[model samples]
Target: MGGQDRESDAWVYVVNSGVLLDDAFASLTLKRKLERGRVSPENLPPSIVGRVAKADGPTVEAALEAAAAAAPVWGAYPLETRLDKVGELLCRRLTERAEEITRILVAEGHPVVLARWQVSGMLECFGPESLGFYRSQMHQEFRHGERRIQVRRCPDGVVCVNPPQNAPLSSALLGVTSIMAGNALVVRAPRSAPLGVMYVLHEVVRPVLEEVGAPPGTLNVVCGDPVPLLSAWVESPHVDDIMYFGSSENGVRFQERCLTAGKKPILELAGNDVVVVWKDADPELAAEALTESFYGSGQLCMIPNQVVVHPDIADALIASLVRQVGHIRPGRPEEEDVLLTPVLRNEKFFGCLRDALDKGAELACGGHAMQADESRDTAGIFLEPTVVVVRGLEGARDIDAVRHETFFPLLPLIVAERAPDEVLLERFVAYVNSNEYGLRNSVWATSSTVVDTFLSQVRSGGLLKINDSHIGFLPYLPTHGGTGLTGGVFGEANYPILRTSHLQGVSISPGSRPREAVFGAWNALLPTKVPTAFPTTFPTKRSQEF
Candidate 1:
């Protein structure tokens, strides 16, 4: 809150140094471009998203210089010391500032409950259990007979993190795990929702960094368009890695740039996740799982964007889903009872709906655009929870409603009614595997054989769930990142501590003698007579069987 004026909704830069800039050259004024509700688009409110100091050439140069100067020293610290100091500090600060952070998120149009959940999730991610889990990956060794081999994890110089606008704080925290492995960081808070993330970094993390005597550039925060800084990073030789979260197209192109510049890129791209319901799955549970499509108004990457159900159970599942979704009503973000809020992409959403309807897809429920309830101060931007039914993947493959990622409260159901059970299963598996996005996928099935087959056959999603909640966070598990359109060539379950670090193998012996020399006799074979030159003579007798 350094440069923030509540009356004008103006906020100052929240940098690692905790100093506010007064000069125009050092600051960038960011106005609220998109807001909740569909009222008065022309006369936008005077809310300031943020007024941050730009990370220009000179500023970024100094930051990279400091980080480069601090890398060796920070990396040399004992792993346990870094873990104890940084992990405990993060947990304490997040808990102490939970209410303040949650309020900021809610004010930014996040449902009150969802905001609380996000805050709590961030806290939990930095908790003791998560720390311990990551610590376990630092340095591991195993003894074999008379020798011991060790696998040591080391930081990859400097990492630049670019968090997405949708979940800035959570994304930044994910990158913070790099510190546990002793890597220096430069984090970019999302411009649209920078306050919560920026506040946490400045108010909570910065003080602790000073207390622990962390190097000046061990952590840096910037708020502005990432394009220029990304270009700078691509050209900078000091930067070693990048943690990027963005659209599939942009992420793929950025990854290419990183590769060209000889830098490592960890990507978390767009997701069009799916939930497959087999004929034998529990109808009630399947319906409940499908409800996740509307959670956070279907804005999350992990939520199921489409449902593929066996025709035998399609009617029952659809009925259950319709009933469950009917209970969800869009309410004001600040209200405690609110379950959903308005998203700003009105044109894209309406276009997708129109395309779906025109393509012969039937709207099962909640088809019309939501009308604002002026009495309740609700903006008409909120989309009614909608369910569209398609015959199968082919029916919607060419339609935007299914092909592209629709980050709104729209769920499309694909009924695979093609043929015999085996053919249906095979086609369904093929469809899921062929999907470009690979964030997460869920399957509802009672048969162990069916579950096993799906898991073995489908090589699409990063995290596959069997009869469990699709979006639930598992701290110990690698729940972030995906494959294909989700994450590019180097895609894997994202564990920042591991992804930001590299593994080195260490071998130990009791003696100083070279292994080759010590085992020379055992490893070598000699003939009766040594032939210095190539010999033409050879024996052609049958050899004895061993």
Candidate 2:
């Protein structure tokens, strides 16, 4: 279904609630450049990937209107019913079409493995563990004799999503969680490459929405210039929240706009993640895990941006990492093992490499442009997976490659100066937390003490991995998001279903006067017996003293 056998002018459907509308593609008016490939997609071979309809600002307004109309009815469904009906079905759809969707992601310039990884994350997000956690986080009931008190989450009325072009389908997965929140969703697909996201909404999400007899406007998809759509949403009263994805700097500004408009801003911004390798770590295994830095040419926010190695084993780790990187060469995106993709404009990559070199960093390996076949070529479409070794924690972040988030295949290995293990560990923790951006922090260590030290002391990133793949996603763990610059204001471990909703405390009492309920409810408490609904551990009416 994701293949290019269809005509070049593939039409992307605009779904309003559960109804599919054709001609969502603007005819004759405009068909933008293919957005499938990374960097400058226009520079690549004329792709079989189809053109997107650049819907106008008015279309975005209409989509928002439809979502606003549908949200109340959708949100009224019992949370359990919504999870069982829509969430359950979406999992099945993803499982059935995993291969096809993977291909579409590859076609959109993601490496094959990254594509599969994204698919796996989607499955895990809807897995049994995550669903159970969602139930706990979304709703809880308490009973005291005839009175019932409930604390539950309510869907934000209408959610507007603007997923980054780098990984639209994965980012748009946030919108699916919005659906579970009982919020109606509107997604603005990236105009550069709208095909993958367009495909997912129809084949995966829309059918489930329809099967459940959801409001026709429960979910909507539009592809166009982001400027118009974003401006329209910020000004529109219908948008309750805008899930904007972009650079951290821009996202911080967008956050202000959302606050001014009384709209919640759920941002998935830039990430400068970190990994720590203690002296006791396995060199080969550590090198293998560090390869995640090269995935998607290091474009993704979750990839390990920098690695801090204990000075005692720094040299060995660097050697192993250089060998591992030699195998991660440039090739076609569809290649089973290809990790490198084209970097159409590598000025920033070279600039960072040069700046680090000038500042006394040693080039470990790979700081050049290369052809698809891994041959050195200045004009090649791809850049080698570059690694540089920056010594000492003192002024380590002064280098751009270490300080800023990189969108290319540039990884810096920071080796702190040798010191006593205790002092070194404290310094490492301090250095890690000093990072302005925090999306993830992974540690590779054999000592339980060392791992525990990092776990207890280090306070950076939204998620952490210990002796596991840094970029791998797991059920019950937050799959995306973080703190500091990565998530702008109001940032934490972001679970879309939770982040997009608000909690309300509800209590229902029968045969009670208003004054008694408000002023003397505790004084008029019933017998000191736990309700039948609650188990033995549940609390019962009693004196204030334990």
Candidate 3:
């Protein structure tokens, strides 16, 4: 999924998959440049449209305004009613447009099957699944003699969302949870990945907003330089909360800017996820699971970057991993099973791999960029899954390839000496949980005790998986963020509702009463007048003076 060539036309019409946009299209276009070279005249495949729009500014702003205006009415309606209109509409529209959306995604850079799965998951999350979770959150109860209060979830007004560029559909789903939670949103779509959201908003959300009488500014979408948009939103008095997904370096900078501007920010940042392979782990299963860590060219925040394996099974695991690595083939985005996208396959990734090799890391399997057998212009980005066997953890430490995140297909495998299973497990857990960046962690273990130990000891990541798929997640299970650098303030748990709302405690009384009197009795029991016992001190002082 590489970038599209620049268009030279002033008025560009982005269409859905297989749908060409003529002048008759009803979609809104806020800007029209007329200069001869103002805009590049490029014929972009529909699949790449979703990723390309992340950089459009006017489009995002308009969407945000619409969402903001609609928030009050949406928040005021009964949860069920709101779900029926907005959530249900989103789901239905997504289903109807799934094929087109998936096609667009494939054109942009994803495998068709993966694109379909991405769109399908987004639809399910906005449907009954999300509605049920929100309804459950609405239930209220109180103990005897306690104040009976309705835990009203009020909208937080205007929220700004910055979606990740890699998984455009999934990133939008992460942001949609906040919208479902009653917050009006101004989403900054991945400038490069705008088609998916465009289809969702234009086909699904717009109709719901119009039918349900959502306010004019309830939701908006913009694409452009994220820094300018984020800066403007953070500094704007109208924007109440900001949800961001990006690298830790970028996330930290955003957090600082928000603090400076006196705005609240919820961040989902980067991670160097760690996967541990124990002696008893299934080598075959472990090898299969490792594929997820390399998916999307290892650009995802949850992809495992380093593997710590036990020596007893390390040799076997390496063999299996290398064998499986050979099967990952590079192809066009429309290919049904193509797993990798052709983006960022340049000197930078090659440089990183070369540096790793120079640092004494052994390349166990694949380690080169593959060009498709097609027009050079259409060659897809393909990197061999390069696995590096490190001498030890000490040698791995401080290595940029191991410590930092690189959006490339590079895996570092560290083999540890044989020890008690319990000790090795504890050490592995500690290492994963101790990293400053905590997004996700995966472990391969057959022993229940080892699993339990890992679960208990691992504390950094937002999500933990035991013998299961890493990136495969459900709607109820938040798939976006984590702690520390991962999500500075907003965690990637099923708490989008919380992120989009503020809390306020209220109490009521039937009659006017002295505010201090309510606690006066308890206060009086302490000591109203405690006299210091003199014990004839005055007489003793007088005698001493005499």
Query: Which candidate should be chosen as best, given TM-score against the real structure?
Result: 2
Badly placed stretches (over 4 Å) of model 3 are 1-68, 374-381, 489-494, 506-546
Per the 3 Å backbone cut-off, how many clashing residue pairs does candidate 1 have? 0
What would the per-residue lDDT of candidate 3 be over residues 1-546, giving only the tens digit for each residue?
001122221332333322211221222121122112344435544322333334344444444555555666667766555555577877777788788877767655677767876876676677677667766664444532333545556678777877777776677666766666676767655545566665665566656766776555656665556777877787676677888777788888888888888777888778888888888999999988887767766767778888889888999999999888766655665666666655444577767778888888888976666655422332335576678888676657666778777778888888885677677777777778777777788889898888888887788778888887777756666665577677775555536666677665444434434554355445456545532222444566778898
Off by over 4 Å in 1: 1-55, 144-147, 372-379, 515-546
lDDT digits (tens) for residues 268-363 of candidate 1: 988999889999999999998788788777787778898899999999999999999876666666667566665645677778888988998889
C-alpha lDDT score of every prediction, in listed order: 0.75, 0.81, 0.67
lDDT of 1 at 176: 83
**Which window of 10 residues has the lowest lDDT sum in candidate 1?**
15-24
Model 3 weakest 10-residue run by lDDT? 1-10
Q: What's the TM for model 2?
A: 0.87
| C-alpha lDDT of residue 331 in model 1 | 62
Residue 333, candidate 2: C-alpha displacement in angstroms: 1.4
* Prediction 2 global C-alpha lDDT: 0.81
lDDT of 2 at 510: 86
Q: Which candidate number would show the highest lDDT if scored against the true structure?
A: 2
Cα-based lDDT at residue 200, candidate 3: 66
lDDT of 2 by residue, 482-530 (tens): 8899987688888989998999998888875554444354445543443
Ranking by TM-score: 2, 1, 3
